[model samples]
Target: MNIYAIIETGGKQLRVESGRFYDIRHFASLKSQNLSSNTKILIYRVLLICNEATISLGQPWLKNAIIKGRILHSHLENKITVYKMNSKKKTRCKFGHRQNSTRFVVDSISLNGKEL
Candidate 1:
C-alpha cells in the first residue's frame, strides 16, 4: 500500500511521500543544529497520514507521529525580477530577488511508533 502524509514546516503545510525529494523554506531551527549533507531531521508537526485502506487526522498535530527526512542541501531559488516605471517623469526602477530554500528527501513516515 502506498503511504503519504501531510506535515507542517516553515509556515507551510506540505504533502509528502517516502523516498521523494522536496524543496521547502529554510528552517531557522535547523541553522543552530549545524546541519550537513545527509543529516537526519525529525518533523513532529504531522497533520495527516493516509494509506490505501485508512486515514488518520489530527486536530493540530498527531501524537507520536513523525516524518523522517534527510537534508540534501540549502540554496537560493531562481531570481525574480521586479520593475517599476513612471511615464512622462522618465523614472524607472528595477530589482531582483531570490528566496532561500532547503532541499531534503523523505525517508519514512511513522505513526504511534509503527512505520506505515
Candidate 2:
C-alpha cells in the first residue's frame, strides 16, 4: 500500500515516504521550512510516494494510513559518557549518552484499507 501521511515525531512533523531514513533533529523537511526560526535544516533522506493521496495535504496519519519501514542502520552520534569518583569520604558521580536520530521510511502506507 502507498499513500501520504504527516507523522509527528521528535517534536516535529514529517511528510515522509517509503524506503528512506531522515534525521529528525535538523528540523522541518524537504518541502517546508523549519518551525523553529533559529534552527538549521538538513535533508538526510528522501520521501517517496507511498500512497494514492495527492501530495498536497493530509492528516497526521493520512486518515487510516499505514506507514511501514525498516531499521536502515542507526544514526551517527557523538559518544557521550561521564563518571566521577571521590576518595576519603566516599562519593561518586556518573553520566550516560544519547545518539540523536530520526524516523525510518514508510515501507508501506495504506489508507482506507487500500495501498496506493
Candidate 3:
C-alpha cells in the first residue's frame, strides 16, 4: 500500500509521497539554521492522509499528523523577466527575478506518532 499526504508550506499546498524528491519554496527555518544535506525535517501542517484503504482528513490541519523529510539542497529557480513599456512615451523597463527553492526527499508520514 502507498501512503501520501497533503502538506502546506510557504503559503502553498503540495501532495507529497514517501521516497520521492520534491522542490518547494525555500524554508525560513533552513535559512536560520546552518544545515547540510540529509538533515531531517518535520512538517506538521498536514491536511489529509491516505493509506490505500483508509483516508484521514483534517479540519484545516490534522493535530497529530506529521511528514518527515530530508533536505537535499537549496537553489534558485529559473529567472522570470518582467517588462513594462509605455506607448508613445518611449519609456521601457525590464527586470528579472529568480525564486529561492529547496529540494528534499520524503522519508515517511506519521499520524498519532505511528508511521504509515
lDDT (Cα atoms) of all candidates against the true structure: 0.88, 0.49, 0.88
The C-alpha RMSD in Å for every predicted model, in order, reads 1.6, 12.9, 1.5
Residue-level lDDT of model 2, residues 1-116, one tens digit each, is 35455666556667776555566643334223224222323232323334355663343233444555543333547778888888886889888887755444446555556655
Model 1: residues with Cα > 4 Å off, grouped in runs = none
Q: How many backbone clashes does candidate 2 have?
A: 7
Alpha-carbon runs more than 4 Å astray in model 3: 32-35
| Candidate 1 structure quality by residue, lDDT tens digits, 1-116 | 36999998889999999999999877646883556788889999999999777899999898999998899987889999999999999999999999978899999999999888
TM agreement with the true structure for every prediction: 0.91, 0.44, 0.91
Candidate 3, residue 101: Cα displacement in angstroms equals 0.5
- The candidate with the higher lDDT, 1 or 2, is 1
Tell me the tens digit of each residue's lDDT in model 3 across 67-115: 9999998788999999999999999999999997788999999999999
Give the range where candidate 1 is weakest over 10 consecutive residues by summed lDDT: 26-35
**Model 3 lowest lDDT segment of ten:** 27-36
Model 3: residue 74 alpha-carbon error in angstroms:
0.4
